[model samples]
Target: MDRQFSDRVEAGRVLAAHLEHLKDRSDLLVLGLPRGGVPVAKEVASALGAPLDVLVVRKLGAPGQPELAIGAIASGGVQVLSRDLIEQLHVSASRLATEIEKQLKELDRRERQYRGDRPFPDLEGKTLLVIDDGLATGSTMEAAVRALRQHEPRAIIVAVPVAPSHVSSSLLSAADEFIAVERPQSFMAVGQFYRRFDQTSDEEVREILAAHTHSGE
Candidate 1:
């Protein structure tokens, strides 16, 4: 049977339930991928009594297929590329460079928008819970985990509401832990499992982070 969620909020609540065992840990912090992931991460942060923040990442799409991720770049100049996919698609060296440069501009724009002058928290020896609304290609989260590793975190746990079982297995080796509320056998898109799959806005992301910050202090 397919499991459907009413919305991201509901998905977050359900995801949080699975994370209850890790609650109240002194070194825990939640980092949400902006736009869609913040709301879901907010709930988990609340459940675990952990501080929340944003980790901006930009997908480097194939030249013509904007929806197809060739790779991704993260806030700290960290990038993860799919060499096999790039070669299969015949993406030229120059073309890949052009695409990466374009996405890096957008990545910087988002980093400033969400973070202002605030520095990323010290993540060394911290148990970081990185949340996203869900995974499709998993490139974005992979970039995030690799970037986060530079900070020497004790562990990186990638959590999501839904993902295909194969996609879930592919990302396992990248993180210390991976958790999802639903890993269905048959999956199309992440939105298909939700009743309300609206695009999350920048203002909403800001509000969620602001609210959590105020409450935490």
Candidate 2:
């Protein structure tokens, strides 16, 4: 697993180039999945001269295996679970419910913290580009697309810098367009593809959003 990107910023720039066709489109909106996706998305928004915002999504990790996502929850009460995984692991209903509740609370907190009094942007009949640093199981992005559908976006595009080949394929039908910079066959983890895959903090997400808002103003 060789590092394909120097950092998220560089990955965003590269992704922006791939998405050059969308530059300056009035109907285009770029929403990044925080907090890592926000930095990558900031670069995309700047490159395309498009409005930038955050789409808060939290992965529902399996109990005692925090890195393995059994599901994901997004804003607007959208919850998606990998039933097959749950069945395979034999996760108890009670345990799953508890995880969902915990994640929902975090989701609510993130929404309030990231957007504050700002209203969610209108997406009706618009082309939405949902971005992340990378895709692993694609569960989080799946939840995001499902939630955004309620807003009636004309099209949804999931863009990432790197993802496993199989994971990217699985997401193709979930979004109007699925774009991945590198779909390595020997994929290990999203972080393995980036030289600087540090944890993205809440303050970083807030600062990026604030800068975007100020620039728009």
Candidate 3:
């Protein structure tokens, strides 16, 4: 063990340990921000005995640096871009629009692949727990919260394994409750805390959802 845990499974176990209090909420729903968030959320849902679903979100990456998100787009055509980053990088409207269109296509493809004819669960008057592997710029998470708010969830709880303190602070108003196990002061990448931070595939996401749904039934 090189300090960090072995994988998302271990991370989820640790995450579940701290969330024992939520195990008994009657109307609780755990929604993972796929595709990386699904694995971790699976563990949390399993431990908490809560129904699990996914919230689709895509990062609008700056040209030449796909990992550097200039903004993020979520389901239902919701987007949140950093104005400062856009002005600083001199990103043009045409470029941002192009990126958003590209990511929206991706988001649609993923939604179709993962969901098929399965309907999204009703969020009205339900306690929603949004799970992600970690939080970085918080743009994607913010977009997700904004999108989810339209559905009128009783409350929105953001749960993650790791995040910077400032990012967590910024999300405090967006989410009804924020829970992060580690708020590292010197965080640079979300992968730093994971021993096996591998890319998650669409098939895996579907399989996890199917298996959990069947098992729960």
The best candidate by TM-score is 1
Q: What TM-score does model 3 achieve against the real structure?
A: 0.84
**For residue 57, what is the lDDT in candidate 3?**
83
Determine which window of 10 residues in candidate 2 has minimal summed lDDT. 72-81
Poorly placed runs, candidate 2 (over 4 Å):
1-3, 60-71, 80-97
- Candidate 1 stretches with Cα past 4 Å from truth are 65-70, 81-94
Greater TM-score among 2 and 3 belongs to 2
In candidate 2, what are the lDDT values of residues 89-208, reduced to their tens digit?
999999999998998899899998999989778788999999999988887788788778877889999999988888866688779899989988887789988888899999999999
Q: Per-residue lDDT for 143 in model 3?
A: 72
lDDT of 1 by residue, 1-217 (tens): 8989998899899999999977999999899998889999999899889999999888788988987888888866678788999999999999999999998888888887777687768888999999999988787787788778878899999999998888776678889999988888888898999999899988888778888897862
Q: Over the stretch 83-176, how does candidate 3's per-residue lDDT look in tens digits? A: 8998988999999999989989998898888877787788889999999888888878877887788788899999999888789777898899
- How many clashes does the backbone of model 1 have? 0
Q: List per-prediction Cα lDDT, in the order shown.
A: 0.87, 0.88, 0.86
Query: Worst ten-residue run, lDDT, model 3?
Result: 1-10
